[model samples]
Structures are given as C-alpha cells and as structure tokens.
Target: MKLFLVRGTAKGTLVPRSALCEPRAPHFLHEPPARVEFLNGTGAVVPCVVHGSPPPRVTWTTRAGQPLHEVPGLRHMRPDGSLVLPPFRAEDFKEDVHSAVYRCLGTNSLGTIGSHDVRVRAGERLGTLSV
Candidate 1:
C-alpha cells in the first residue's frame, strides 16, 4: 500500500503542524485591582488573574517596595493570585504603614507583565477615638 501525507497551508505557503502552533505570552485576562478602602480591623482582597501558554508566577509588592512574602502575617498572595490583607489593628494605623499602593506582577518563560497600581487604604473605624 502507498500513502501520502498532507500539510496545512497558510498565506498560500505549506506549513508544518509544529510551526503552526506557538506558545503565547502571558497576559492579563481581567483588569488589575483598583483603589480599595478597608476599615481598620477588617480584611481586604485584591484580585489578579492572568493567562498564558505555560502559566505564570504571581507576585505582589507594596508601595514601600516590600515583597509580600516578607510582610509576615499581615499580608499574603492567595493561590488564585489574590492578595489578602488581614484585619489591621489600631496600632497598625498609627504608623500609616498599612495604607499604601500595591502592584501585581505575572511572569513566565516568555516575559513578565505588571498590573495597574492598586491603592489600598486602611482607615480608622467610625466613632473610634485614638488615645
């Protein structure tokens, strides 16, 4: 028996199947986080979703240039790329360190992409007085 193989054509050129498929770079599937305000002693979440051919690593950074992993128990990145900020105590507000901008970065073999700046603010609860 005799047989022949056929290849796909693109732009009038015969192309191999392998050449037709290429890996796509990472990209944001949804808009980045926006300005969010959380009452002191309340939790907050920032969502960041990305898409790519090989998937990507998600990282979070604070306005002070501190990495999320270094923040200890105060903040962390969820499995789904959401930044979780746990409830802040009154003392946390005193230094105004918890209130700052946050940024999300996605990285893959192709390249790296950054999300829009997200401003996170922690404010004192209503009717609460500082001693």
Candidate 2:
C-alpha cells in the first residue's frame, strides 16, 4: 500500500516512523470460523488475527455494519483483536448478538481489510436430573 501523501493530509496518515519496511495493507493471519456455537449462559471468543507493515487496529462489527461493542453482552478485546461474548441467561438472549454474522475489520495508514463472516449463536442448555 503506497502512501499518496496528498497535500493538507494529516501527518499521522503516513506510515509509522518506527517501521522500516514499506507500508503494506492489512491481511488476515487467522480468520474466524464460519460459525461459533456455545451453550446458553456460556461465553465464547471470536479471534481475528491481522498483520501488516505498521500494524493495524482491529475492530469487530456485524455483517450489517453494526459495531460489535454496540451489542449488549459483547466485548471487543484489545491488543489481540478478539471478540468476547459474555454469558447470559436463556431469557436474556439477544437475537442481535446470538443470531448475527460478525466480521472483523483491520485498519491502518495503508488501508483497511475485512474478515469473512462468522455466525454466532448460543444453543439451549439442558440441566441434568438425578432420580
């Protein structure tokens, strides 16, 4: 990814000074799976590994462009680019989070890239009974 360096552009838009190599757009190192399933009240993690010349900032969002953090019970973990889905009771299930397709975006000075869609859902949990 070459920097156009247009006039009046912010200096921060250029490649990081610490980076020695040429600027490169973000690419996925490890993409999230097609689907992630967890039991009710059990949490799950969706990992998205992205690498670039100057390191990109990863953000999670739904396929519909809704930010992952905007969804209740979902957390965007920093420094690792992983989405954390917090545990919640069956009655507290949110369709927006449980039945949504998520995608991770890696953005940097060079460019931005998006990961494949990943569907997240929580199955009903059954309790054991002793006679």
In candidate 1, stretches whose alpha carbon ends up further than 4 angstroms from where it belongs are 1-22, 64-66, 94-97, 126-131
Q: Point out where model 2 deviates above 4 Å.
A: 1-20, 70-74, 126-131
lDDT of 2 by residue, 27-119 (tens): 999988988888766778888999997899999887888776645455446569988877777787777777678889999999999988888
Q: In model 2, what is the error at residue 118, expressed in angstroms?
A: 0.7
* lDDT for predicted candidate 2 compared with the true structure: 0.76
Could you tell me which 10 consecutive residues in candidate 1 have the lowest summed lDDT?
1-10
Clashes of 1: 0
lDDT tens digits by residue: candidate 1, 1-131: 33333565454555555544456677998646578777777768878998776688888876665676735557778899988878877665533336677788888899988887888766677454222
In the predicted model 1, the residue pairs found to clash are none
